[model samples]
Target: MEREIVVIATSNTHKLDEIKEILSDFQFDIKSMSEVGLGGLEIIEDGSTFEENAMIKAKTVMNKTGYASIADDSGLEVDAINKAPGIYSARFAGENATDAQNNEKLLNLIANVPEDLRTGRFICAIAMVFPNGESIITRGTCEGSIGFEPTGNGGFGYDPLFIVPEYNKTFGEIPAEIKNKISHRANALNELKSSLKVYLERI
Candidate 1:
């Protein structure tokens, strides 16, 4: 059987790997937007919500590649900070802030909040667009609290500061195999997987 060609709208290699791993059960020739000769194709994510941002990228890539495209927008939302840095999680410190810098800013912002009130969650929104101009959107979230300080050096982004209450460990401290199953991105992609199977069958 021939593999279906799909495009993932992201230049980030890590995201591509995670998405590919989750969808491994299916026979898909998943390629990053950059891999499909869409390298350096910058699409502005000016949407106020994660879903809107994900759709923008997905639709852009689908229009360009004429193939099914998947895109996701994810961020950390701290309840103590009024869910701030929601869409700006990547550039919380600045346009080119590093992970460490972003973490520092978040810590300082919530430093005064009591432990019980230091709640937060990781949010992920996935958008899939097909050549037929049809689109599907889904959202997933992982509830947790921000740690007092960074821990472990495993995962990236806010992994070190986001603590899973069930395990009492940061994402950076958890194993990749486990994190891949429970992360916000993981949840969203899993939901998308189910939808994709049915959608593909109908079309």
Candidate 2:
């Protein structure tokens, strides 16, 4: 059987691997933008929200390649900071900041806050755009709190500091199989799966 080709519009290897694993049940042949020859293209994310940013990326790749493309935008929102670092989560430290820098900035900002009040959540928005100009958007969230400091040695981005209460561990500490089941991206992808089936059928 021939597999349908779906393009994932990002260069982040970690995200690419996670998405591929989450959607592995499907028969689609997933390819990252880098694999599709658009890796050098830079799409500016000036949108005000995660959905908007996701749409921008999806649309850009779909337009450029004239292929079905999927993109996601995610970030951490801390209730203590009034949901700050929402859209700016990637560049929280600066435009060219590293993941470690961003995590450090977050820890310092909430250092004095009590453990009980360190509530936060990870938000993710995903957009899938078909060649025909039709698109589907979905969102997901993982509720948790920020730890006093970073821990563990797995996952990426803010995973080291985002605590999952039920598991009593940060995302960085959670096993990949478990994390893939409960992550914000996983939730969004779960919602996207149904829509994707319908979209593929009509194509």
Candidate 3:
């Protein structure tokens, strides 16, 4: 029989949707933070790096539920901005800033920056916390540049303005299937899957 698995520490429905889609082939049933009734744990993500944040979220959730949990911290790092908004990507504009506000602020910051200086990449760090309190960590990245303006309304966050150089298309311009295959989140999740496969094999 397959071991039961539950993803802890995130109420963001979009994150849950993507993770579920990515790991759809697994034998385990995946659930979101809300689905596990973890709406009470207000995880304070004050870490300076993605790994620290991921671990914090995962550990917090694991401590509460005693279930296998996964958490990730992802952000866009801009070359010209000195890798700024690195850990602060979500709250770049302020704690209460909306997606539009954050995007607008990012655009303005790079408004005068030419195409060559607009290089950036999305970084993701995933942390998995086992029921025994053991943990596994992995990371992945997708390089791209900031577009002149937001385009294609397919995704949330900074997806509309992020252009993948190899594909020459904004993330929001790609279909979910295609995006899920090549996104930063997908890359990180791949590492998680590899670890899962190893764990499963050992059992």
Expressed as tens digits, the lDDT of each residue in 21-67 for candidate 2 is 87887887999998889979999999999999999999999888887
Better of 2 and 3 by lDDT: 2
The TM-score of candidate 3 is 0.93
TM-scores of the candidates are: 0.97, 0.94, 0.93
The stretch of ten residues in a row with the least summed lDDT in candidate 2 is 194-203
Give the per-residue lDDT digits (tens) of candidate 1, residues 57-150. Answer: 9998999888988999999999988998899999999999999999999999998999999999999999998888898898999999999999
Q: Candidate 3, after superposition: displacement of residue 37 in Å?
A: 1.8
Alpha carbon lDDT of residue 103, candidate 1? 99
- Global local distance difference test of model 3: 0.87
Question: Runs in model 3 with CA error above 4 Å?
Answer: 1-3
Residue-level error in angstroms, candidate 3, position 51 = 0.9
Location of the lowest summed lDDT over 10 successive residues in candidate 1: 194-203
List CA RMSD, all candidates. 1.0, 1.5, 1.6
| Candidate 2 lDDT for residue 181 | 88
Q: Give residue 165's lDDT in candidate 3 (0 to 100).
A: 86
